[model samples]
Target: MKNTFEELKIAKSILKSLDDIGFKVPTPIQQKAIPKINSGGNLVGIAQTGTGKTAAYLLPLLTRLQKPEGNDPRVVILVPTRELAIQVGEDIAELTTYSELRHAAVFGGIGWTKHAELVEPGIDIIVATPGRLWDLYQEGVLRLKKVKHLVIDEADRMLDMGFMPQLKQLQEIIPARRQNLLFSATFSPAIEKLAEEFLDFYDKLEVAPSATTVSQVTQTAYKVPNYRTKLNLIRYLLEDEEKFTRVVIFVKTKEHAEGVFKVIQRKAEGEKRILHSNKAQNTRINAIQAFKSGDVRILITTDVSARGMDVSMVSHVINFDLPRDYDDYVHRIGRTARAGNKGDAITLIDPADEWHWKNILKLIRKDIELLPLPEEVEVLETEFGENQDQLREIDRQRKIDDPTFQGAFHQKKRKGSNKRSFDDKFSRSKERQKRKKRRKL
Candidate 1:
């Protein structure tokens, strides 16, 4: 295994930057992916988030590009979210600080003028979200004819967010003879198909089993009775300021995000921010900056919006609502236990969420130990919360799929038959009709 960044034969300038950042020993993904990427061959890296996959591709690419040569970006990194684009841009900027490399990060949610200004001058590398990149390309502000290297970060996420069309459009834009690299925490079938189309005979490398959480994170679940109890638990846990100093709470939807934010805002003091799709871009950016600067102690966000968060020192990651997509569980916990730091992932599982929690366990293919709530946590009722919301949604869907299927919730139960009275009445009516037909015959 390649133990040190220096052992990778990177330039002294880049090595000094890595030293400054305390990135000495290579993580599993970096160790295997670095050398192969340096060889200029197509590669697909399968690893979890916080495993240093970004540096695995970036370090090698940086070493290869000695200096900025032309106006068009020679290297391009496409991410699904604006937040990830910013994070990759920051990573590249830090690494290239010791050397002479100009990089630009471009994405939507900002004015077109800002992105045009960044691309007007030559850029060695460009990190961007796909939509904005395509937009700039259409506007004649961006070009890929000179792109020598192309990297797609979070390939599975791009598919989840429905970026395949933009990616396909990019297929027609980029130079055919470029070095390609795709990295994902897990490889779903969609990612597989995309990789096949994007790469030309790439090497497949797996640092760990697919969908596995990092070993450093101590993951555990709590059997909370309901949403109010979850709120109480959050208050109780954050009460220990020393242990839960830097925390990120993950919810499922913007509505739920708002609800959780309101409760936590009322119960807790100190700097806390909420992130979702609806908030202004500046608001989201400021929230993350504050969280990273340690100014914000609590950051409540939706999984879709939080994908770009690369915070390493988060003390705890609490799942306010389990993701409907089980794969997201890996990414949620990944926000903590980063950069060789030990952290905790506490998931509050309600009765309805128990089924999803089981799928998460099965998907990760391991047993995350369950911890009994502190003898002090308040037990709550199941009258409201995401569980109720989910039930209501399922009923709505059932109505669409089968009009006659009254949902488990909508039909009242019969006293003796233990069946829905509506169904029982329908059955008796059919029986009476059959008896009347026999008597007439």
Candidate 2:
């Protein structure tokens, strides 16, 4: 087995760029994937996030497209989110520093005309989101005839975001003879179906099992009472600035993201930023940049917003709210413990989130340590509405497990209670009749 990039038969110019960027050895995924991709066959790579999956595909594709070709792109990389598109584009830019390979990263939120202008000059590689790519193609500004390499990065995420329709449309448009490369963090049955649709006859390469957490990360959970208490716990943990220096807090909803960011902004020691779908594209980009450069110590983001952020040296990842999608827990934690660096993942599990947390455990197939609430952190009483919401969620989970089981909130009233109500109504009607008769007499 080849261990180094050079032994893998990488081009000297690309190797020089890699060395300059401090890439010493190929990651396991890279070691296995680079060869298969270079073989010029369709390939499906299953690896967890933060495992250099991007480079595994990019290095070989870049090698194949060493120089600029036709006016249209020879390589089309499809990412699930704008963040991922930008990140992949940046990687390409860095890797091709010693070569002449023009590329463009096009996505939504910016004008399609701007992207058209970008590709009008001619591009060898085009990294784009599905929606934006389709728009450009439809506008006749971008052509697909010369696209020989079609890469679907984060296939699972694409499905989650409902990009299958666009992907299917793209499949019909792109030449059938093109090589397909699909990279996903998890290889579930859905991904298998996706592979069948996209890849003709591809080789499968898996570095790790699907939904597996990074081994270097220390996983721990805190059983909190409610959201307010979770905030208090976060404040308590952030008191240790040295330990929680660089943190990414993942929340389930934009509201939660905002709430957490506000709390951290006032209570936490260092700089903090918030990211969600509501934020402007430029704002989101700048926030990611700041977090990546270590200018910001903390980033509070929703799962959607943080999908493709590739930041190194993240000391900790805090799950402010457990993600509804079980696989997302794996992705959220993978944000830390990257590049062989040890990191910590802390999850705050409230009553409602515990069910999802348990499902996450089952998905990862591991036992996570549940830490007791810290002494300094005050566990506030659960609000009435919050308690009701927790109960409702629990009831929903129960119904999912047993379809016959009626939930507490929607349970039918007892026969005796119905009878009593009926009798009381009858008695009230009789009394009203008696009062009317007395008035008449």
Candidate 3:
């Protein structure tokens, strides 16, 4: 008997391309998704990174594209980041190499005229970031009416970046009859609401256990005293006599990303690079490619690369700063242990971060043994109250001199009293009006 995708009855040419790409058997996600996709149902594929999800949706869409019915772009894929856009575009290109169907990538980092030129002949598929695509749509350079398929990849990230408004606007502009496919590494309840808003009567496809970390990765954590101590621990970890050829360290903020990059550059006698939203687009792309090519030993990046990164040989992933969200923790660890290779992930957790640490353990449903701090370094109970003393002093000064806080607090109380007083007066006025009416009667 034929497989699920084959049973979906894809076109011969598309099947030929799939076979050429060495895709005989579909992954669990593809297995579950292809059949439903062939049935023309809106699909929400919720699986972790590296689950062959790109092919799951691409193959089904390509099957329909090979039969060519209308002109303007037929498939539209929206991604959160430029790197993801490029990755999706490459995947589409690989699947359609033998076919005449064209694919165009639209993102902010490159010149729009180049993208405009590519879009001139129109395309079978357009993979883009929400902001750039929204700009083009508003400028009248792109048309969504001819779009037959709409795919929103990384719905949670897109929502986190505040693209819901743009997505709703795009939905209003695009034809209502298009097939919708929403894919993400994790499907939280918030993502579910987005799927409902975007897709009608969609079939949900989940490839792995929700909110679960990759089994192939070894997860470990260390408790540090403070941010500076965490940095020292990262330096110590990277300098281990047993070194990894390629390592990606995830930081929580843009400043921290640059700071880590500097520290690695100064301390390591090896190559390193920095990637964050603050960097130019080309710089970010080149950094990713360089790291993938093993040209860069260490890549310091913010959460931008924690999701949708496809590098297979990443040997180690270090979380210099533990992410507050458990889902983010899962995505951060996913960067490593990909393509059937074993990888290691280590995190530095400060006492202040225990709240997030607790949430993470709850999400993973496992006990994460906390590694002892380096003996040379000192460890102490993180002072939650001491850290806020500076802010408290500032508030005190404001109350003594500026009077802004005290005035605001008193003004709020006065406003509340006035509101209550107005309500009483209004009630008395209404009662007087009722009595006057009764007297007249």
Write out the backbone clash pairs for model 1. none
Q: Candidate 2's residue-wise lDDT over 82-200, tens digit each? A: 99999999999999999998999999998999999999999999999999999999999999999899999999999999999999999999999998999988998999999999986
| TM-score-best of 1 and 3 | 1
Model 1 local distance difference test score: 0.88
TM-score of each: 0.89, 0.94, 0.82
Which of the numbered candidates is closest to the native, going by highest lDDT?
2
lDDT of 3 by residue, 239-308 (tens): 7625676898988899898778777677775679888877887788888888888888888888875455
Alpha carbon lDDT at 419, candidate 1? 56
Superposed by TM-score, candidate 2 places the C-alpha of residue 343 at a distance from the truth, in angstroms, of: 0.9
Q: RMSDs, each prediction?
A: 6.2, 2.8, 10.8
Model 3 lDDT at residue 247: 91
Candidate 3 stretches greater than 4 Å from native: 1-24, 67-71, 241-243, 374-441
Number of the predicted model whose TM-score against the real structure is largest: 2
Regions of candidate 1 where Cα sits further than 4 Å from its true position:
384-441
**lDDT, candidate 1, 411-441, per-residue tens:** 6866676655898889999999999999999
> Candidate 2: lDDT of 120?
97
